[model samples]
Target: MSVRVFVVGIGSGDPGHLTGEAVAALNAVDVFLVADKRAATRDLVTLRAELCAAVITHDRYRFVEVPDPERGPDAERDSTAYAGAVRDWHTERARRHAEAVTREVGDDGTVGLLVWGDPSLYDSTLRVVETIGDLLGAEGVTLEVTVVPGISSVSLLAARHRVALNRVGRPVHITTGRRLVGEYDDALGDVVVMLDGDLACAGLVETHPDLEIFWGAQLGLYDEALVRGPLREVLPEIRRRRDAVRAARGWVMDTYLLRPGTGR
Candidate 1:
């Protein structure tokens, strides 16, 4: 009677991005674990619920809303502090997840956590599940995890821009906004930056005035916006539009690709 948890990727907030495997996983689960963090993310929470309703046909499945942990201010500061804070947050979230599973789910029931992007990507749901298993193991609750991969924002970004992620014989470098600031190099080939809250693309444009940028916010959503051109030329518009969008929506999820040439 082991507990089985499926970490399912819902694909950048678009139901159209759902794969066959993701649909099957969604229907197979008896419980869906949803994390309601901030008011800014209410749209995402709604989208997850909408997806569940659209796919799951039976009334046997239920949803469990979990209050997300408070991440310290250190997460927005330095790298070391951010890592430590995230680890602490994940630990608390794992405890909450285990509690929810133990209380709401049957011994052999299948539970699911819908992640925004692929679990193997920048998402931390898989890591939290690992911690959940560790915390419950000593209490005689055995856990088994199954990963169902779905579309990633990187794939959506490239598809929306209609460009290849890499040039011939070159590799693509995927990094976060924090690391992109100091680690960007011309030798890294095409750079795809994600989870950037600080407009790191604008900073990159300042440093490398000739670099080309393909930037998109709220990818695959109804109000999705894209800006592309020489970074210096498009930086102002991107900043202005991004600010306006964030103000309107209360939050933003954006990613970009920094190419070396003019993209010609």
Candidate 2:
């Protein structure tokens, strides 16, 4: 019996965002493995369940929640320490994933891991899945990995803004808030930042006086919010709106496009 793991990107929130391929993958899965983070993020876990219920026509599938291991806070805030914490968390995650796959779906069944955005974009499921394969392998269980891409928050952000990500002849760069904190480079034609609830662009307000930002939160969902304009003028508004969203919903997923404001 072999296990085939499908890392399916379920998009930001909407079930309608599911591509035909993602739907097929959903139907193929015998069990859908989800990370049970905590009470604060329970809404996100429920959202994934609703998405699957809406799209998957079959009732043969089951969902198994894997309790995510708690990570210690890095008071040092050093990049090295932060990465080390993440690595240790992933190691435990791999062990739990291997157990869940075998216990619920068995070695002969297929399972799916629902990723919020495109697996390649900031999500760590693929990396953890790679380790899961190794763990399963050592157990004499054959494993196969498959990734189905879906609509990313960046795509949803562009659609909401009704704007393209890059200027003519300009390239687009995608990065995280942590990286954007200090790695805000000038060479990229356009910049898209994700996974940052805190305004990583706060510092750029003065650094790039001509900087412009297009930001959105809870994208693709009914309560979605959007803000744009000069970095200086919109920074406060973004902070207000972002904080409101978190206060109201207890969580927020946001993405933004930053440009040098050379034109338009």
lDDT of 2: 0.87
Candidate 2: worst 10 consecutive residues by lDDT? 70-79
lDDT of 1 by residue, 60-111 (tens): 8988889999986753578788888899999999999989988998889999
**Which residue pairs does candidate 1 place in steric collision?**
none
TM-score of each: 0.96, 0.95
Off by over 4 Å in 2: 74-76
- Worst 10-residue lDDT window for candidate 1 reads 72-81
lDDT score at residue 7, model 2, on the 0-100 scale = 91
- Model 2 backbone overlap count: 0
The clash numbers for all candidates, in the given order, read: 0, 0
